[model samples]
Target: MAKQALGMIETVGLTSLVEAADAAIKAADVTMTGWDKIGSGLVCGFFVGDVAAVKAGIEAAAEAASQVGEVNSTLVIPRPHEELGQMGPWIS
Candidate 1:
């Protein structure tokens, strides 16, 4: 099943954050849907082929981000459309 993981990271230095982000992206085997900087933090959007990939991606991103600053992450295992309702459309 497909999986998605979102990462929120706060960095003390911009250079470190950028470097970490670049490393994380390069390290990832999964597809990265999006990535953006918010203030002094970062938001990473990723899609994976399976649960294992999702977990691995999250761990990799966290490890890389920690080199720069603090990292916080959330993984969402989406349910069926009917269960998600409005959230389904947003995710898609």
Candidate 2:
């Protein structure tokens, strides 16, 4: 089985994060875990799937979100550490 990967897209506004989540869902076979508000108008969207899909999803998300608002940062962790799951629901 392929190891699951985690993808995150952080944006400067709720609308950007929402757009990122939508684009990620449509562009790849990943599952949207959930999103969180990071204060200072920053929001983050999370997703999980195979490494390639996660990477693809995040890339698509960032591109789509940048059109409407600021994309602060994006990350993809392939085969993330199991301990990370204990942090929150979005990690797994």
Candidate 1 residue pairs in backbone clash: none
Tens digits of per-residue lDDT, candidate 1, 52-88, equal 5545655666677677666555454533234443432
lDDT of 2 by residue, 49-77 (tens): 99999999999999999999999999999
Task: Estimate the overall C-alpha local distance difference test score of candidate 2.
Answer: 0.92
| Clash count (model 1, backbone only) | 0
Every model's Cα RMSD, please?
Answer: 4.7, 1.4
Model 1 alpha-carbon drift over 4 Å, by segment: 1-24, 36-44, 76-91
Best by TM-score: 2
Off by over 4 Å in 2: none
Error of 2 at 64 (Å): 0.3
Relative to the true structure, how large is the alpha-carbon lDDT of every model? 0.49, 0.92
What clash pairs does model 2 have? none
TM-score per candidate: 0.51, 0.96
How does candidate 1 fare on TM-score? 0.51
